[model samples]
Target: MESSLVLEKYAEKNRFYREITEKILSGKTLNFEEALRLYQEGDFYFLGTLANVVKENLHQKRYYYTINRHINYTNVCTTNCKFCGYHKKPGEKGGYTYQVEEIIETLKSTPELKEVHIVGGVNPELPYEYYVELIRKVRENFPSLRIRAFTCVEIDWLSKISKKPVEEVLTELKQAGLNSLPGGGAEVFSERLHKELYPKKIGYQRWLEIAKTAHRLGIPTNATLLFGHLETDEEIINHLLTLREAQEETKGFYCFIPLAFIPEGNELSYLPGPSALKILKTIAISRIILSNFPHIKAYWVFLGVKLAQIALLWGADHFHGTVIEEKISQSMRKDTVVHLSKEEIERLIQEIGGEPVEI
Candidate 1:
């Protein structure tokens, strides 16, 4: 259907939605207040339709996925964020760290792997050489593979451990064949939430500094937001806008991923996680706000396969990847699968009338 006809059909009854729809159709960027209003008051279906329009304008129904493997190198973390269930305190039982060779062997076992995602806890025990060696060996063995490793949080920890500036640390890692940084640990950009939820982790300014540094050095990274916790609507929109401002400067963020908060085994388990409607609304709002971003991911690991599929039409273009193993979410929800086959991924995208583009 034409954009005007679609808008007329779904949004014409409400002037607020109709005006917003017209503004989106005309290619005008939404201000922070406009985005917050759309997220707070616009009809859910109207939001989805308008977000899909913006998505189609950019990607034209191409849904991206990757044949990637996630390797959580260690679970012994010192930064004990209340929302996390994956970390073990230092020297705690069940805390495990992978040797460089073990990671290589795991890669050897998987066939047709295009990318290797490596992330883990802030282990003070491991020397800085461990990280460099891990990256160097992975690059040596899988010369063609893409290595997306470490979050800004982990990078900050590495800087402290190595006694090197973040720039030097990222330079050494990039030289050792780190392809990009994953978007984790950037739960929310609000200082209130930072102090309340994850006081040990790096604050938003430092996180953006590290990310912008990576961008300046020619390394692309993804951005993420962890919602459904103790964040208000204004805080969420501000987070997206802050990222948008950063992207305007660096253009380094390759994708924006809205991660649904999973409140299962964490300290905040008493609070129920975000509902499906909340998830879809956030994803759509993320697409509308982060115009500088090229892709929005409905990370299937947290959203579950079905909702992630629905998210494709609601403004998400990335179905994440065939994550061979993801220990973080699995630690919280026992039923979370460690892997999804390529056939299954393709079928899910096809069922939603999306063409899967393997990255």
Candidate 2:
């Protein structure tokens, strides 16, 4: 069918769809109601088309990946959030914490590494100095590598344990060679979800505060939303809008990643995870709503390689890097591959008619 015929049919069937399409193409912003309606009732194909237009307008045909590795320094956590499958209680049988030298040794083995993502559970056993020393040692060993470490949740825990303010903790870490913060721990922005799902972690207000503080200190960060769980459509839209408003203020978010919930080994194992349509719809909606976000990522670790390829056409511009190893998702699913070679990544992007650019 011709593109014109499709538009005509849609326009005749749904006037609001045509109106919103024109509104988006005219370079106008989507308000809360418009974005929410699109998320709830918009046609799947048309939604992807509109989101792809927005993506191309911002990033052209370029898709980005990075040569990075993830370091799960420790799994012993006290928080024990219900949705997490990676955390182990202190002194649990499988728990481990890497010494600073051990982390350096792991980094030394990876070739062509550009970034090291360091995140772990909220382990009460480790002293505050250990966190600083880890960053310092990573910087000492790999001076040129970008060190994206910690989430707002971990930072809040550090502040409490060290008897320092959040700003002070961030400043100390920055001085010790932290480049930026990752966008985990922001499960959703609703207070109801915060209390229901991750009451032990920091709430949304504190997360935003810590993120904006990092931005003010010249550290850029990414933002994320964990969907396909117990969240409603309104909660999802509100989460994106909150991030959009925060981005308007600080301009610090590097990317927005919509993480699909994997309900394998967690407490929510009874529930089925998000379907392919929901995943693609969420990605497209994220790109449409988060206009200030420079990139939208199709994190293959959660979405899988093939579906992630389809996501590239539906609004995502970043295929999250050659993560040498990621333990969080691996703990939940035994089939999760820990590494993807740069060649494999580029081939996957190119096969989908995308130009792979390594950042």
Candidate 3:
């Protein structure tokens, strides 16, 4: 459909969206039914306008990016989820795990880094002490760097290995200086897909419980959805709504990152990935639907830099930092660079007329 005709045609047929738009413009919140209706009936331009209204009201022209780095401590994992192309078995030809000293050395080499985003495979061989010591050592060395490490999946695995409850494990990690939760290991929330992809991993409800526990203990976290692969629109809406309800309850989710499933080295590589339009639509709809969620991030690493810049206007307020080294995506598709410089990220934000915000 033509962009100009989308709003006009919908305005004539459906009074619902028009009414919702008025509410949105008037700074009123849309209820669940209204949001679901918008997802079903709202046109591209209409959704974009409503989303932009929210984005501008919250942040104006200023977009957020981070001066950070990503460190994948180990690629060895036991779960072996079908959608993953990065995990390797222990003692496998390509598997590697970084020691605490090695991680500290790497952190020392990189200066002016605001955050260190760390995630790795759920390797059972790595002792629980390794993770705790890693966080303690990093925090001890760099008191200022925000350590956003581990996913709910890792936490679940940690609890199992350490024979501790989820809350107890989280408490120990927080005591050892774990700052926040990185959004990973949450591929989708649909039960059917969840089992097919990651049967051995923790269930969706378990993931949410772990997150809620972290929130209760004062650890803020980012939420994510891996879309564009065997999931339906209803499943997507359900996933978003689930996160929305959780956010409303705990107020711990800081951002919602929509991950476009990259089909390359995974078992689902036979399927095609999402299109650019779908990606933008997901980003824009996220802003409109997740009303309580404060920020939506357009991760340049997964979506690519150019598409990420375009997503800023599509209602994404956060650009994931200068990921100095990203391995998970590269493992799937080995054609891209492993790191992006801070200046390059700033220039990309500037080109889109967004103020580069670093924190």
Candidate 4:
């Protein structure tokens, strides 16, 4: 009876996107051509309505969040990603690296932190032990804490420095209590953007390879795409489809996060950022395309709390976390607010008629 009611509601609500909406409701995966049509031609409300159908179908009313602290252990980096405003040279005035003790002390001082999000610039000066011991010490200090740390780019860098395979590096980290891999460092995957935006970092294929390798090793990972920069609609579609193909094979990705590129302090500062409508459309399209992905996060750090709240209606089920000190987004120094406490985050979710879920 409940299923019939949902089906009737879906049928009535999706008239604007009847063809594609029917296909989605029938549990058929959309093809690339159809996805392109939705991007080029679908109504914003229709697309969002379709996406919300999928979201509620998968997760019901439970919107997920976590009590996590972002620990950017170092600002000293070697890569020259043009979109990055966070990395600094070793001798730069603001460059800093936290000792293991400092990280543990920060965690100890903070209360009810369920997860620790750790990412940093690719600093060659830090020894292999620095990376290994960081995870070990954190695990020792907080045995129950979930550590969602490192990007594929960072993992590739570690593989280079430790002279080990990506699998080995991930294995050691997992043994040291690494819970999962965060999806950062995956900007747009176009070759043109690669040349202009992040020539130094590994390309999309290598990033995908690293992610698949991690999944094969039983390490759950998240995937992301940074949009609203110098990428065409086709390139954005290509990025989503590529991740969808990956998820089909491994079934390891936990969530898909669409990061809006903030061009305030970076080399791309001259370009305009994505509008709120475009952000919402991107979220909706991501949900429509990456059907295999179980979650979509509207990262409140990049998207302000208000916009992130709006994203829940569009299709996003996750709102990142409390993010005590989100340095990467903060480093941009844009006109963006940073960090929301658990209470505040809950209130924001409730205001949108969403049930804030923690796990």
Highest TM-score model number:
1
Q: After superposition, how far is residue 310 of candidate 4 from its true place, in Å?
A: 0.2
Residue lDDT tens for model 4, 135-210? 9999998999999999999999999999999999999999998989999878887888888878889998899899
User: Order of candidates by TM-score, top first?
Assistant: 1, 2, 4, 3
Query: Per-residue lDDT for 345 in model 3?
Result: 80
lDDT of candidates 1 onward, in order: 0.92, 0.92, 0.86, 0.88
What is the clash tally of candidate 2? 0
Candidate 4 C-alpha error for residue 187, in Å: 1.0
lDDT of 1 by residue, 93-161 (tens): 999999999999999999999999999999999999999999999999999999999999999999999
RMSD of each: 1.1, 1.6, 2.7, 2.5
The local distance difference test score of model 4 is 0.88
* Candidate 1, RMSD to the unseen true structure: 1.1
lDDT of 4 at 297: 95
Model 1 TM-score (2 dp): 0.98
lDDT, model 1, position 190: 94
Reference-based TM-score of each model: 0.98, 0.97, 0.94, 0.95
Clashes per prediction?
0, 0, 0, 0
Ranking by lDDT: 1, 2, 4, 3
Clashes of 1: 0
